[model samples]
Target: MLKDINLNAMNYFEAVARLGGISKAAEELGVSPSAVSQQIRQFEQQFGVRLFKRDKRKLTLTLDGERLFQTTTQAFRMMRDVRSAIQRQRENRHFNLRVSPSFAVRWLSPRLKEFLDLAPNWAVRIDAAPDFSDFETEVVDLDLRYGEGGWTGLHEEAVVHDLVLPMCSPGYLEELRALSDDPIGQLRQARLIDSVKTHYRWDFWLARHGVMGERMVYPLRFDRSSMALQLAADGAGVVLESSTLALDQLESGALVPLSTAFEAIRFPAYWLVCPSRHTSRRIVRIFSDWMREAGRVHDARAAELITGLGCRIREQSGRQLPGEEYVGE
Candidate 1:
């Protein structure tokens, strides 16, 4: 039972001691200082040992605390090494991934390098279409999907929930400004590009922006989002692309937002869809963790960009809207 004692308390103590203060430990762990202090107290009580000497203005480890910290630190390091060893073994394991072509091209392909860096030895076979493969019959370890969460008999972890927004290249924006008085309205006068699979169109965006008019302006249509984005970048037209797809371009100033009429469509998030029973494979777990973390980082960056731009736009327009001003979902 003593060997089975709470590791969380041990973690709290180690963090506090390593960081030299409860407040700093809290910041590192994303918790409150009070929480860290309480955990340290509870840990001391559980072990019948004083882990820290609290002076009027500072916290320092006592002799016993130092000893315990040294031992626990080594123990934790060993545990982490063991975990890494296991993950290294798992990385060499074979797995298959199924994903849509557009998702593969726009989102996953760009970030494959990061994933490869994390799991260097892993063998990944990517099938870039959801059709023609049966998860039960096929040997696929995971499926990345875009849809409503209606797929039955599978465990789905949402990688990203996205929203639609109009994105144009900087050159296209410059041209629109130079060509017409009503840049926003004249912006819509140019050719519109469409994604064939996902039917969410410019009308959906325009209606959300309270600018209702004829939307018969699609001169170019593509089955893949990557192509449409390329056309937009070349100043062919404006596209209603997902914030996730436009994220890299938007950051590099290759693309700019047309308006703040983004809508949070509740599509089935980019999910790591896996058959429920066979997910015990070690490789699957590692990839799933990697995908989730990557998704979180991407979403955070997209939100930061959207919020920054949204504030600037609001200040420039001198108008405020109800509800959360458009950010990526």
Candidate 2:
């Protein structure tokens, strides 16, 4: 039955189903709307089932259509994987990695040279964006993602657990101290900076430290942690951020921990993710090993930094916290 089916018509049907309109699919496929409609019609007739139902000029899938769409989506994904594999065979030394902009700028980018130094002959590409990479269609061989693991169809290895706490410039800390002798009271009056996209937030950290029912002021909000860290480093406000991302600032004394009396929240923050098919590739394995070792070194340094500040580590559970969003970085 599969061999008897027209693959071209099926392709058009898949496109129309995916795009939800004949005109849109036609434009994408560089064909006429009439051509797309005809192909879908032929496909439905061949299967003896109505694949789509139109209501108020909007196209929606019927029950059978949904099943077919899922199958076709997976089929196309497999084809793309095959194409990528073929390309990789021709140029196996090319390494394409995707990561969040904050992670790229604040953490991975600075340490990436070590990987390059180890593999001098390889071509490396780092694509940093806010959205997660679609491994099925994207050319990324690996993704250095900062998030909770459990992404389907991918292998996620926990790279590191980072301590999240409030940090600010030494000058800002002095100003905060001048505001009030009371530590918790000082937080209420001092400006708060937020890394909007991160799951960890000022509220969660404060509440964990037994400080509650106090109004905190947030004068600045940034989607990227790098920007928030910079803002704190410039004495703008105190920022609640991961130690791993703020390593440079803390090490350089640009940012200081607010108080060691409060414990730092530790969560499984970073992961090295990739499709299972690419997991066994020589380049992938080599890079993954290097990343694991790098993460180990980073973990030690971050621990020492937190310890130096006289801060204690408290493990954060998988439960959702206030202001937590399931997003990258």
Candidate 3:
């Protein structure tokens, strides 16, 4: 039976082997040359072999030394890997969810509380980025983005597909309600609050209805969709934006949809993204399922609040939006 070896001495031996000389290994280890040499000698003596054959300043490993080095090197590396893995376990309670600024404020922020309340033991860190997260490199456990489906190399699931309608506060809505004789004419006259950054612009939506706000020399410009929706809710101006973003305001009667021209944008649907490998994780699966259901519920609630053109939407019976289940599963 072999005796237990000194781990520290073995480390010194490994360093010597890696560096190819005792003096250099000593410098790297922040130790005196004599100390490293002595440690190396002791390690070799314990193994009962001449591990290295020295020539001038060169230290070449013998056959026996090569075999020992191969085993010990792998063993030491495994020790480091084990320690690192354990350290990760001790402090890896939080998982990251990268989201767009617009989605973060308008949709995700309110719903996050529910997730936190539900999963008290698990922590979620939201990284609200203006641009897309690099799923190939970034430590993004999940991402929420607006895009057309078929995101290659990553797992994605459509969360919400909402109608873009003209939204405004109660007084503004009431004003539009009075012009029921010519709703489009009144809408064209009003100060168009435009979300400048979005791909689906007011021009695109207006052209569809055979009328463009072409007469307006300058519309109020907000850089983000969430900002436009908030301003509109505050009775700032009429913002043509997604109903999903303004769902809370719509429900609260703070903001109301001005037109029944509910245009469902095909592209740029809200997609929950992650590396394909991560879907198998329990927490990820749980969050994915929860988010999809929550989106459905939100849409249903938003649909209930749509009072446009002197009409409220009463679903014929259990009628729901076209759903996109989690693509990862």
Candidate 4:
């Protein structure tokens, strides 16, 4: 509500004052000198005050014009500062990512370097835990969640489906192979590593194979899925969890996927979660696309390994556990 404050007139006044005359300002503005004079005349008429004191050869600012010029210069200076700040922000590539603890250790930590290489100037700040800080009021830029979608006030994009199955150290696999040439039968006797985080337990997996829950032997339990998978990698026991979570161990031949006699565990997929406003952000979308491609690559690699190890169930009837692109729902 700035009464009688015409921005266009103010702009012309500032230019004429800074350039020292109407003709010079007109040249700078790419307009005729009469146009600049007309705009200034509109200003003086509206204000009922003279803005310039004309002499024989040169024009000088009136007392009123001098006071207005000070304010005009300061206003344009602030505008310049704001524009510079915005441009600097456009150049900055730091991103804040919040992730579940299990995914961070098992998946993102190992592969993050590759994504960083995609954008050399970009740096990421990761906050890992079971839950992330609230995105509504917090500064978290993006998040990953393992859940069924259908939340309000937030944007959700399902990135990848988590496939879980029994896996253990290579030496443990060797022992199981010795116990029986029959894969499913020997897995029943193999020591099981219990993960307290997920619902996929030794008993549930064993019952699918017609073995009673009590028949499966488990000597240790870990509260986090990553910890349980780590124990399995260390050859403590067999772990039933996300292959994507145990990616490093599986890739390094530390842990081997067991026979697919028990169906691979599937639940709601992992989602790329963000505030709705951030959904359109270039960096956020770039990261989302990068991760989706990463998920497909992991699925293809897992499929290749599963086929190589003779663990792929023909009943699954797909080339691989397929990856998915995000849809805003």
Candidate 5:
């Protein structure tokens, strides 16, 4: 019967063979030199063969050791390839999604149930942050970005086109109604919550409306768009936000639109960004379909809310604005 060989000892032997010294192998393996030497000794004893000729300053592989190293190298290489293939298969069965924190919290979280319902067996890992760059090196399977579809070297698909409108909580609207007869004038009097870092700003929305007065400038600045939305929800101030993120609040009466004049910016509605090189894995394709459906649902809801509130939305072509009667699912 062939003797059962110790795998750990063989691994140590392989490391030493590749490195040419126990000290080097130890350093690579993050173990002590003594430990590597002991493992080599154990391996030699098991095989009943001296695998190395050790001098005061150097070590060389024996004839038997050379032959063994050749066989073991091929063996480990095959094992490594097999392991990698298995890992890729497992990853194909799952998805790692990355999104901006604001989109994840204000937009995705509210609608994730629908996605889960559609993809019951699929597992998802959401890495939510403001940054959505470097998806390829990070090994992220998918990313959602809030920008124009100009992410160079990435495969991007438009999820939804966005329109920015003034939104405030019901309490703030009540306060405004109490303070001033003109809602727009009252909005100027109230604190204006702003997201200056985003490509789409309140100033752009104001410019579209031809209201480029000093009131277009907001005093309170928020680093994240989500924070500005939350503050607006809390009745702190009016926020110019995407209808996609504010749909739930608007539908639930938590937030009210100040006016019907919403501006559709050239900024990417929303983008599903992925590495240009990565072919669509099964999980990624599934998630992509889910995202497309989610965007449709969001757009439908936003349109519904906007129509119900009698809001006017301009199309990208700069044509005459569509009438409220023309808006539908």
Candidate 6:
């Protein structure tokens, strides 16, 4: 008898008993009156008892039906309470974040304290990895990704439009200038530090400026932008890197523009990516808003720094430029 009990039928019966009419129950459940009537009839047949006593236009529960109704009501109320508790816990407890190592260190680490202060009650967790988060398997509430957007089935918005340029230590720039007066000659003779995993490499910057046919050698190479920027800051070599990641080094005078021959090339460097459902959560929305505002502030500061260096910013084409021949070693 316990195995044969239908929860759906019990739910329908509970609705009809509480609402006093089949139509009222159906309206609340978003179903037809006939559907509710069928379930109630099946529920009665299963128990071999009359769950409802029908009058001209009313539904009153039998003694057996009243007893069952009390149990069902208590059970449903408990379930609803559990669901609400879980939802509240998820929203108020912690926010999980995923981002690249370079971004985490250079961009987010310093600013994270501001967010923590804003929500002191919430615990924040960060996972800095190159791989994108699998929202299905991971407990990621937000993902700050570096890409051109268009992630399938996820909501993605451009958070940072970063510019790429060649930057090196002030001392290194002086040495390169001493080697040759011409910008192209200095770049050819000087060691270029290669950020091996960057989309906008030294080759891309060179090709965009039509600095072709000259063999450019990259003796120092690193997969991470942070390492490459550190190398450049230490006066090792000029590194083609994102202004967003190199903002601190630039501001501190540890790194300066390699040349003013070309403008900084713009690209959508960072994106706020998450599923549609998570976007509605209060904590996620608050954090996202803070990040967007922070990006705006950072961009303004970068603009001032670039203008101070006697340089300008320009948008680069999304398609790759045609000059890979000059890139070697």
Best candidate according to lDDT: 2
Q: Candidates sorted by TM-score, descending order?
A: 6, 2, 4, 5, 3, 1
Residues 1-329 of candidate 5 have per-residue lDDT tens digits of 33598889898899899888888999989999999999999999988999999898588999999999998988988999999998887656666788877778877887788777776766778888767657646868888876655567889998876666788998888888788877556766777888764555666556656655565568789777777887899988898777777767777888888755443332346778888655457667777888887777767667766777878666553222232111100
Off by over 4 Å in 6: 1-92, 317-329
Question: For residues 1-329, what per-residue lDDT tens digits would candidate 2 score against the true structure?
Answer: 68999999989988888888999999999999999989999999999999999887789999999999999978987998999998887676788988888888878878888998888878889888877888878898988888878787789999877888889999999998998878787788788998888877776667666766647757799998888999999999889988888988898999998887667888788888888988987788888999889889988888888888889988876845543446668
How far in Å is the alpha carbon of 76 misplaced in model 2? 39
lDDT of 1 by residue, 1-329 (tens): 86867789899888888878888889988999889888888999987988899998599999999999998888888998999999987765777888877778778898888877776777878888746347768888888876545456888877775655677887877777676657457555667787655535565555656765575467798767778888898888888777677777888878787655443332325777777875787778877888888888877777678666662212111112322122111
lDDT for each of the candidates?
Answer: 0.72, 0.85, 0.73, 0.75, 0.74, 0.84
Query: In candidate 6, where is summed lDDT lowest over 10 consecutive residues?
Result: 320-329
The CA root-mean-square deviation of candidate 3, after full C-alpha superposition on the true structure, stands at 9.4
Models 1 onward score TM values of: 0.61, 0.69, 0.63, 0.66, 0.63, 0.70
Displacement of the residue 55 alpha carbon in candidate 6, Å: 51
**Residue pairs with clashing backbones, model 5:** 147-268, 148-268
Ranking by lDDT: 2, 6, 4, 5, 3, 1
lDDT per residue for candidate 4 within 1-329, as digits (tens), equals 57658888888999999989888999998999999999999988878999899897587999999999999999998998999998787678688888877877767888898888776766678888676458768788898876555556788887766667888888888888888877776777788788765645566566666765455777887778878887888887788887777766777888887665555654445778887889788778878989999887877776676666656433322222134222211
TM-score of 4: 0.66
Write out the backbone clash pairs for model 2: none
Quantify how close model 2 is to the true structure by its C-alpha RMSD in Å.
17.6
In the range 145-233, model 6's lDDT, one tens digit per residue, is 87666678999987777878899999999999999999888888788999876768777667767676656877898878999999999
For candidate 1, give the lDDT of residue 106. Answer: 79
Query: Considering only N, C-alpha and C atoms within 3 Å, which residue pairs clash in candidate 1?
Result: 147-268
- TM-score of model 5 (CA atoms): 0.63
User: CA shift at 115, candidate 6, in angstroms?
Assistant: 0.7
